[model samples]
Target: MTAPLLGHMMDVPLLVSSLIAHAARHHGNTEIVSRRIEGDLHRYTYRDCETRAKQLAQALIALGVEPGERVGTLAWNGYRHMEAYFGVTGFGAVCHTINPRLFPEQIAWIVNHADDRYVLFDLTFAPLVDALAPQCPNVRGWIALCDESCLPAMKTPVLAYETLLAAQDGDYAWPLLDERSASNLCYTSGTTGNPKGALYTHRSSVLHAYAASLPDSIGLSARDAILPVVPMFHVNAWGIPHAAPLNGTKLVLPGKDLDGKSLYELMESEGVTCSAGVPTVWLGLLTYMRDAGVKFSTLQRTVIGGSACPPAMLRTYEDTYGVQVIHAWGMTEMSPLGTLAKLNWEQSQRPPDARRALLEKQGRVIFGVDMKIVGDDGRELPWDGVAFGDLHVRGPWVIDRYFRQAGGTPLIDGWFPTGDVATIDADGFLHITDRSKDVIKSGGEWISSIELENIAVSHPAIAEAACIACAHPRWTERPLIVAVKKPGAEVTREALLAYFDGKVVKWWQPDDVVFVDELPHTATGKLQKLKLRDQFRDHVLPTAAAASEQCPMEPLDANIDAHAGGGAHPVKSAATPD
Candidate 1:
């Protein structure tokens, strides 16, 4: 190792394999703990996991799993999944993660599209595989990600994951391979529509994980106990599992059950210091803790993403829960993590609420992430907060393009043009106004659905709101506001409309309001406005936009005529359930 080229860039092989080798070589006793058979806990150290992974790799090769063949895993985040993360990919096969939450058709399509030749699934998802196995041609066999006793009683051919590991030589050596070889494939969250697979090379996944581990990003260390609440199938649980082991962090997995009671118990038992998940997960945990009289004396911070965080939601965790919630922003195209909201030390002294307010905005871009905002005309916009524009990002770990999307263009001039419309202030905070598709266009002016949703969540009675653009036939498109009232709470459209007063421009208000049981979410937990639009496309208020145009528009209500601003309110009409 002649003067190991310090500061010089090393590719994915050096980043991934070398780190595991070092861990097995040095910090081998660090534990990788997980909840296995529902209530039962399973644990393994880095030394055990690495050696098992080596054995698994040899087993895969012996089973005729060709290099570059897509190896699918339908397991929860745990020691076994972590081992497969290395075994399949480290041995030169592509790892394809199939989300269990997806509709059966979508799941089948993803697995088929990726040409998965082998599937390693937890016994929990055994029924799903049994039902779909007949349809999946490329999947030659199934490997149960559990011990022999936990194997499902199914007629389909199944191999016990642990049993197979038992038969392998623990000392099998890793074969030398090119750093640029394909390593993993993850599809976009099919929220808006169909999914597309993003091919990750060994070089790309390793690089992205490193950037995520940096201080300005996740800053994971061996001293921290990291729990990933996000499912392993979701962009490799935002790549935390891989990054954590590389940086020697103590890893904890909340397998199978992700509810608050289970997670809280594990966090306390494991002394988990850090966790990452979506807003919904925290919502349940906070609710459970408040009701169950539980406390996390050691839990310090949480990273929340998948959807925007309401300022109020941020306040609860930071003020009431004693846990810091750092809002992050990203897409599947960016290897998932592009921005994190870990504020600087100076701002750390701010009051809890003030700090929570800062957490609402997507914080500064992380290392290896470059962002820009451009208007509809493709010209770059100033960073001034008022000029909200489409966000574009280009980074080393971000997707250059999708896999096998024959002629599709996912990247523009080397930049992965993020469809989010956000504004970056001089201080580097990102205030995302809306998604390009969700922004309602009233007479060519944009109305942000995200703003309405954020504001709606602030109302005492509102649980959630989704503002969808409805065809007006005159104004092109107007907002259709839908709210799901909190349990046993009476919140009419009139009440929600009143709550929005003075907070946003009058013209930004939805022309029609609807109360619904729930707002649909995509597979990744994002609001599905496209589905909302399709659901309500035909049903529109005939007189809503017309009234706005007929009256004299007010200053605060840009599109409203003076008389229009004071015209018959949309709430007076019946809330459209359709």
Candidate 2:
């Protein structure tokens, strides 16, 4: 016969309370440092963080922040945002992060869309808020993240964020949390379609945080000073804010200014060991270091995500800066941890250059996620790493449907279609070739825009490039290459086309090249291919006539740099939206 059943209560609240609550009982004297432009450089110990989060919870509840109501933020990567992150969610309210870089209308639309009752914004975003206030109807209060004297003179009802924190009494009774309660909500950049929210449950978020700290994952620990150059609005800053406390890592926030020099100062002063950001950010930093003679002898690791990280960029960091590049890939819907290309034994054994080549891949799928590639006929393909197909996945953390199934209600046996066309290697590494819609199909064959982009970037003369599907009459579609040059560098049509020689199928060469100042991007730094397609769709070399109609260009064998467009001197213009 069994004795009475015994068990430890399971809950996120319990975990957070232990982390912040009995500080000496769990993590005593652990440092939580935050820096902003002026005022006091706040230093909250783990115990202090706990006390303050509970206080903020009390303040939020006093302000009528009922469980599950949306609380939005338009702020930078600072303590104010961090407090809001924990305090709002700890009180069982949903934290909706509005991407401030989005067009004001888009920001207002998201705020109104979520029916957010209150907003906490960075002080630098004052004018933007002033312009958007009248548009967000449900928002009852606006809290600018500044000190009492720093409050901007504005027409709207603007209260200082720090003042509220100072006014909040440091005592709160956290509610009986429903682990399944919505904890955080973030929207995609809406490159392919309208932006939709991906609401994350507390359970999923906590699990992601746990998985993120594993040795095989980010492997963060207290000894490490972690800085996430990524914005908080982007999938909870890829869950770094929460994972840091769980892993006991000292966190760094760059605040409003995220330039390379600014980031460098923080990295040096904070003794930061690990950082993560999009490829564009590091590209700029690499240049900054070269010109300024800056060195990161202290930085050991960096995680690159958000877009395809070119191999050259990866090599520059690993070789010159003595930093290891950890390639990561995920989407907002996936709670953002899908794959990691960390160094394994075999991969580590490869020559540095070869290993850099492997790191260029999206890497193997992390645990808790299942991935597959399916042909147009909907048949699952082999993991040969060459046969590309639309990627579909499902997991406890990945979204089963978008915030609302906005991607056309695509329903399969149980998989959520991820739009990315990729191949899985025998080693389980997932290489994203291109978005299915961005791929160029000619004469019933598919050509990877990523393959072409990689080839284009290899050219010393070409600084960046983007490939879009240009209309072709006979073959149906061909790659129209848009490229940029280095400073004062000239690239003639023949010279650029010649670079593709002996690289890929001659027919795969771009039908025409357009010299563009820059390629457009969605709100989140992804190439806006749909817009590119619209801009060059009609300008492709007049397609070879069908056998029934007329002419055909010589087709044969040959070779090619992966190209990028977001490089120095990005020629910016209205890239007429698709």
Candidate 3:
């Protein structure tokens, strides 16, 4: 065998700190704007951000933070949290971003599991910090991401962020470290047991940032102002914090105000050209725009992910407001960027409906990622687009294993099982049909819950919808549509059941429609079907009965706000008779 040839090139590591330093050196004037917890917009340039980030690194060192130690943050998307993105990782420490939306117990468990030494939290989460301080004994200090005056009086001793920065002069250099050293940590929303962590290395994060900034991905550029309506605690705000700085694009952080009105105001005020978030957040923004009869002036595009974006939402954004919707899909495991639904030149020239139909799929993988589908027999499926199977992906950014090696090996034959049921067309576009566990098996055939839910939400009266499996006598399990209606909009179960006609095969149509006052969602805005399945585990489908009366409709909450935050959507109730 011939000896491996080595390329003669510079051996510089791809550190997260280098991204911010590059931005400061080249695009020092680019703004990092934040709607603060203190109830005002705070703005700074990349230069200022870099300097403070250095000071933060110095502060951490002064406070006895050691190399490779985990520093946890329970803050919103803001200037300080952005600094921590560079500072903590830059200082050779791991930046552990804890989702504040998780239960206090879960947060404490994560803190302990990560063995975080210092915890920094936004002022909005001060009370939460106080509650968690006693629980997280390993967290030596609790620092508020706020000024001294703005800091709330907590039972635990909390340090002020400004004070810590003021104590240090920006005189630190990012250390040279191995590219594969762990730099960031994020836990998956442990739906089954305890949440497991996805630890990211400097090399993977930097590579992810580069790929995510590509034209086919988020298409970031210097001229654009980007607002990450996605929480920073959630998959690094879908990698916008890094990509924005990498591209010298203006970063607009909407702190805590994820509701429709607040986000719309923030985007307009900042002249945001591009934004990224889940479907529920966009639902809020669209609701606000429709109610106010207003259109976005500067907003040109949006990246929707964290859940399957309904086609109706995409059409409304593009046709009504001239905003192009970039459908995206990823998980906490893959540095959270696997596929983006960008149309190729040929596909772009297609008719509006045809183009949208293509975009409704999860989209194609960017460079650095490889994906394939496998059937139950473990054989790879063909790319004919109709043959659905388990989606598996392997790439430089995807996790080889979980942090602490919690769940054993998640890969199968070198491919990471994405827990998604998908199909890849010959053109290489990936279409996510349903989650592996969420797919309903009626009789011997498989049914896509996502397809049914998408069709349900397409109905004007439906606000949000979830399709779950219901126990059956013959079929073993049948499709059930548990939906929420828009305020004051009345749609009977018969009408909804009939609405599915012609759109899908007769057997694939949901056997019953059960409306609820609200639907549960995960912290990242994904529909929580597990909870719904449990809630309706004993539900008796009307079809099974010989004769049944019409199901009683629950009264709609007159002032129900669909755009409300907190991982739950308000919905109206109406069920098919048993």
Q: Best TM-score goes to which candidate? A: 3
Off by over 4 Å in 3: 438-578
- Which residue segments of model 1 deviate by more than 4 Å? 1-15, 345-356, 438-578
Best by lDDT: 3
Model 3 over residues 325-404: C-alpha lDDT tens digits? Answer: 99787777888888888889999898978887789777899999999999999999999999988889999988889899
> What ranking of all candidate models by TM-score puts the best one first?
3, 1, 2
lDDT of each: 0.72, 0.70, 0.79
- TM, every model: 0.75, 0.75, 0.78
Q: Against the correct fold, how does model 2 do in TM-score? A: 0.75
Q: Write the per-residue lDDT of candidate 1 for residues 101-219, one digit (tens) a residue.
A: 65566678888889998899988889889877888877888999888887879968898888888888878776667877788788764433457787777777778778878887877
lDDT tens per residue, model 2, 303-395:
777655555566668777899888787777778777888767987898967776667787877678789999999999999988988889888
Cα lDDT for residue 169, candidate 2:
78
